[model samples]
Target: MISVVIPTLGTREKELIRLFQSLSSQTLQDFEAIVVSQDNHDKVKELLAPYSFPIQHIKLDQKGLSLSRNVGIKYIKGNIVTFSDDDCWYKSDAFEKVQSYFDQHSTGIACFQIYDPEKAVYYKEYLKDPREKVGFLELFRKSSIEIFINLSVVDKEKVTFDEDFGLGAKYPSGEENIFLYTMHQEGYKASYVPEVVVYHAKPSLDTRLNNKAFASKGPMFKRIFNTPIGIALLTLLFLKKLNHLEKPIPFYLNSLGEMFRYKKSRKR
Candidate 1:
């Protein structure tokens, strides 16, 4: 069975409904949806009841996405675990394809394409051969919606999301990238499949670099890579995405500053 874990803030009621509707429409029905709610728990439970497949609603008092995901992981019973965002919905054949791929390939991690309905494009600008082995740099391009993991592999390695990162934490992003990195470090093999599995109708703001979100990258860099590597990566990111940021100069300086500050705090 495939266990689909979704961590939500209960804010996207409309999108959440859409997501579940898609789940109900899936060609494969051997999956359960675990909705980890951080707010409006009761309402979320009520909202999820109408879905066709088996559903589980877990309430969380905390706000961090990583924390919510960790909570969902504890309750998962399926051998294969998948993650989906509250705002994203899967294609009808997604789960079927994922299950088929894992059955054929002996990989621990499997990634599919994440398409943006608004942009009318898949997230990966460059496509490799389908079912190609993906390592460090390639894995970074993935998001939660595009990936599935064999729980047995990750459980053996004791891998979980980093609570210090992700939405609603001090760091506002890079949790998925780091999680995949951790899995790789723990000796898991990840493969990329060029199939459209999920759709991301992202907000316009999601494309831009704001102060708080950009600043989080400094610490993210330090945590996932080394501090020196983090600084270099952050610098390159800032340079390449300068036009996407409102206050490019100030944001770059503050981001580097925050990285150092986060490092210092860890020592205390």
Candidate 2:
């Protein structure tokens, strides 16, 4: 069976309705939805009851998206698991395609594309060709919503999302980057399928080199690489994306400053 763990603040009643409604239409019925609500348990409970699939409403007092996902992992009874955002929904055939791909492929983790149905475009530009396997550079571009995992291949290790790197955390991003990198280091195989399996709204920002983006990315890149190398890469990235900045030097310096705020994770 497939398990979908969605982390939410329980405020998206309207969007939840739309998400569950799409789940109800899914051609594959062998999946469970685990909604980890960080607030308004009663409201979320009320909202999810009308859905056709079995729903596990997990309440969490904590606020971090990564923390909620780590908690959600413990409650999963399905062999195949996927992380989901409360506002995103799957296509009717999405689960069936994923199950088929997994049944045929030996990949431990798989990443797919997200489409913005209303906008008539992909959630972000995707690689045109599917990759049989991918690594760190590929993971950096992926959002949490596009990932699905085969639990059996990875259950032996103590793998969980880093709470210090996601929404409600110090850096506000790169949780997936760190998690996927760890999985790769653990010797698990990952694949990139060039198909759109889920639908989400267009992001308000897409890697624009703004002050907040610069600040968040500093620690993210630092955690992903050696300090000196990370600093070099960060500087290179700043200069590379300089066309997006009005004051390139100050924004570049902000990122340089924040990189020091995070000491790189010790080797496993």
Candidate 2 residues lying further than 4 Å off, grouped into runs, are 204-209, 264-268
After superposition, which runs of candidate 1 have C-alpha atoms over 4 Å from their true positions?
Answer: 202-206, 264-268
For candidate 1, write residues 4-116 as lDDT tens digits.
99999888989999899999999999999899999998779888878769988898888988888888988887889887889999889989998898888888888888888
Listed in order, each prediction's TM-score against the native is 0.93, 0.92
lDDT by candidate, in order shown: 0.83, 0.83
Per-model tally of clashing residue pairs? 0, 0
lDDT for each residue of candidate 2 in 195-214, tens digit (9 for 90 to 100)? 88999988654354567667
| Cα distance off (Å), candidate 2, residue 119 | 1.1
